[model samples]
Target: MQGFWDCMSLWKLLLKGKKGCHVSSCRVRRLMKKKLPQAWRKSAVDLEDCLKQERSLYKQAKHTYAAQWRKDFLTVQTKDAKKHQWKSRKARDRFFRLQQMKQREEARHRCCAQSKGSTGDLQAIQIEEHLSDGTTSLRTITDRRLVEDGCMQETRHAMIKHERRHSPVHLQVSKDDHVYFWPRNPENKGSKPHGLHNGHFKAAIQSPSIAYCDALFRNIPLTTGFVPLQWQNLMNFAIKKKPGDFRLSKMRTIQLMNSEAQANNKKAGRAAMQFAEAHSLIPDGQCGSCKRHQAIDLALSKQLVWDLLILQRRAAGWISNDAKSCFDWVAIVTMLLFGLTWHVLSSMFNMLSFATRRICTGFGDSKRSFCPPSAVPFQGCGQGNGAAPHLDLGDTVHHSGEDICASVQAAATLWLGGIRATGGAINPEKSFWWLIDFEWDARNGQWRFCRKCSAAPEFDLKIPGLYSDIEPLRRLEPDDSERTLGVMLSPLENHNAQEAQLVSKGLGVPHLFGKQVYKHLEMILRHMLGGTKPGAYMDANLQAHQLETGTSFGLLQQDYQNTSILASDTWLKRVWKELESLDMYVAFDSPALSLRWHHDALLIDLFIDLEVDQDDLLWLNWCRMFLQVATVSDITTADGRYIRQCIWNGFRDDTYRTPYNWPRTVRPGRPYWELWQRTLSRALLPSHGQHHPLLQPLGHWHDNFESWNWLWSPTVGLFHREGAAWTHLALAGSSTISRRYAPSGSHSGTDSLQ
Candidate 1:
């Protein structure tokens, strides 16, 4: 009975599978393996394959069901286009027509009033009479399309020149013909344009106003090197680097130069330290006691060593990266901290409402009639003990009363903090002034303008968030009548940055005096040449070199009729002829140039001009001949009469204006000519050095030995002084302007000249 049951079970299991064999359990496999190993193994493998196939079929059916559900339920609903269609074309046309009419009216109003409306609107209104884009009429559409296509097709339009000061169209039209703008079309042969003038037509000849020099005019190069290696040169070198090399050569060169600079700085630092020690600025073993000692230590510190190198290089006009090294990084960090400190100080000054002012009597009368009780002009601010506190950038002195002394002191402290934060206080020379009146209302902790004040309602000077009741703040006025201290900041006329920088680094001695001297000489020369008035010549002599080589010879315009040049008549004439022939120089006419004796500081009021050409031989001959002729006696004429050479006693540096006029006026004196004589003479005494006297505070020279020598030197030569040395003038003459005296014989001082 047991055998039959087992056989039946086996048969049942084998028959359970459809399309494949089935093994119900691993236990059955184990039993079969013990009884019939091979058969059991095969059946087990078949069962596993059947299971995998079933799983894949079930998965495929499930995905199909999900896809069908999504297709039916997740579809987006859209409205029909037919339902949203407009009911009628008439309504749409009406709406567009109304918009067009509104735009047209707005454009017309704008055109009449000259409002800053859109250009499209203006163009639309102008073209509306011929064609309207809003109109549904075929003619209107066709016209619009034709106009656009015509504009597109036209390759070029004839250019019509117009007067810069005149408008193309006039609003006050007298007729329909005048209502339109000047038509650009060539076919229109109507009345001439309203603003059209005969400017292009030839006019009657007229004489020029300003007289120019007859000598060759060479425009000087305005840029020059401040040092042996200028920053611009370095930049040029950097720009020439090969594109593919990643600028390695330029960078390497810079690095090498930087290293050399570092070494030099170290040497300088050592020398400076030794000098300080020798001067007793640094005590033995006490390194950080004195400011000098501290400075030395700071300079020598590894962090600052590179910074000093970079600073020195920059000052000498070398391009250098400030933050390219460790020193720069340290400096950046320090400056950042300093800047933060300033920001905090500025915030405090603004928050605390710190300010200073004056309150007292007037100049003309003790009674304050000139100034109202509520306010006063800047001139009538005060002249008493209660005047505004003396607050300046450097070590400040508070002039406030005891009651507000503490507040003023606090404010001063903040100001000092700001100065340190900004690296230093502003240069007194660079400070500007403006007229302003500050009001304070402690009650509201704010400032407001007084309605009765002379300033307009819009011209209030009150700064927001500041309050002070001690006194009203009166600032320096910009008005000519009220301005007391500084000139207003304005854009420089004909500004050239490169030229300005070059001029700044030029001539240690002041050049303005020389310019004045030149002007005097020119006037004298003109009077001697011809006693003619201005406007005697209308045109200038154009040189051949100028026409062909594009190099200008002589000024663009000159008045040669009034003055004449003789090739070999007088000494000046001969000198001028030779100089002009050699393309050297001849200047008795340049208003801003003056030749002077380098020795004894003797001024050569009139003589041959300098040859600034870069020729060693030419310069040598020039200086030799100039000096030879300058220091000699009068030349003997053909008729046995001595013709005194045109030479005058050199003017002093202080002599900006001359009292010696030619009895008769050739031209009206320069602005403030007479006034400058009286004012400048008293102000610029020898004892006063470069400083002006009590009357005027502005000084011509700084309080230094170099400045003193530059201003007061009586024996310095013109070529020897200032940047003339850079022109290779020092190669020829005794660096001094003076030469050894020659015995009486010929005009030239040298005996060698036969």
Candidate 2:
């Protein structure tokens, strides 16, 4: 019987889920297993006998015990669930009747327009009237639910799924002026978040305007892949008004379309066409004299410049994951937890939720344009160069391959032109670009593609594919296999195993699904506490490596984003491989990128406008001298003008963004103020661990140094004042140590320093 229970235990963790019942059920079952007769275990050997003898009784016992445990585990949740529920039908009726009575009495006392201290039917009805404007207000009738406006505001934003909960779909003449909501009270003991997008993040993004809607673009990605040739042809045709008088690229003529709320909420395609026509491209200012090159046409130059900059930035580091790692974790976990998470288990129940095999974003919202509250009427600043109509994937799907290719290029060109200097943030982006790559499979029939689209570089030249196709969930990849002492391990080990079974395999969190997670986890455990092999590593080197370089400082995992990479493959590979040894990386781009090499780190940075471009090389040289990279060679050009460069670096010699960390923005300013080694080293190192160096919040440097400052707090190694000691732990400038007095030429002394 004990063996039989153990067998079930391995498979049925998610199967026997309840609000809080997991721990207790295990205890009770264990107790029963100990008490059961040894002969009874033999009855479970034969399938028929096992079922006939004790299956029902075992299930009943487990269920009863599990339920009790769950009640205890989630007592707060259990209580919260009863917020609005009545005990019986009669009680429910009585509550409503009382609400009605109160409303009637209020009507007699106050104006029908406004009622205070009211939790009556009239208030509810009035709120309903207001809701017509397309708003969904999550209300908490009890005062205890009223959280401080500032404190719980973030939580409130999370509840409003802008995609589904658009602010009151239609405008309504609302009678209730005061919109009551379930306020967040941080002081409440039971207060906790239930989903992604926590308080601070939600607070930052909340906008109480119209429904959180995305820009409706007509040429959105489609069911069937568009033909690259046809797409390009369409764009060429659109722009062929006259050769010299280049007009807006065909792709620039974007239009918006509404998206369905749910997958099955399909509307007529004709309505979509109507939407496209209604919201056609924004006008671009025309040329006053020569019609040759309108602003729209000239804007390409800007786009071209931006494209190059993006390439440069990408080389620096900004990547998106294409391993589908995010989706896989969710699928596996959902499967493992199917028995427990769902309301009730079915005979056909699988631990993982097969149907919910979707990508799970940590918290950041999807990449939709963020616009102000009002839709500003766009006038063509440059002929056909301003706000154009949005494009959607669906329209492009119906188009030919040639048109699709052309559209893609045209869009890319336009996108590249609108670049701006966002200080350090802009440099890596300007240097390199990261594009997500996906494989094609025909396992599912959801997608169709044109095989020949490859030659055009506008579409996949590899093969036709669909999005519906995916491989089955892998139970345990060898890469992720960790070994613990099978014999000595306790029955209930509360460690990453639980996280793996639930969050990783069951809930399917994406980050943990990757190969890197396993590698890092092994390093982390070995460094912290010794355990068995595979599951627990005793590799001191690996642990020390993680301690000094990697982010597994005995923590579960590291969180980072905004990875970019230069277009140079050789450079990217070299940089990544190098980082493998040093562990100085925080993805400026995706992991799959190749970067361009920059011997002159500062020289390879962003210059507002290309020509009048700042001598980044000279700047880097200056930095190296100041930061104490004085002995570090190969950081400059022979002529000393800093290596002449462009964003189009492809060759190994051409500067790229890889071998780069942080890929900092080099805004045009006091170039010689800091050392190149310090700046580059700072960029190379992730702002992780206990010691992060602060670049004295002085100068017109930047404001968003929060992530950087936090990641690389004081290195606490050394310091150099004007008179006293001097060391270069983690402060800014290897050579620019904290000096009490100005010593020489070129070094400007600030009053604050004195």
Scored by TM-score, the top model is 2
Candidate 2's residue-wise lDDT over 196-266, tens digit each? 11232234224333112211111121222121221111000122333366444312221111111110011
Tens digit per residue, CA lDDT, model 1, 574-646: 2334344435443222222111212111111111122122232222222212222222111111121222222
Error of 1 at 1 (Å): 75
RMSD from true fold, candidate 1: 38.6
- For model 2, state the Cα shift of residue 659 in Å: 23
Off by over 4 Å in 2: 1-123, 127-264, 268-622, 625-754
| Alpha-carbon deviation at 510 in model 2, angstroms | 23
List TM-score per model, in order. Answer: 0.13, 0.15
Q: Which ten residues in a row have the lowest lDDT in candidate 2?
A: 256-265
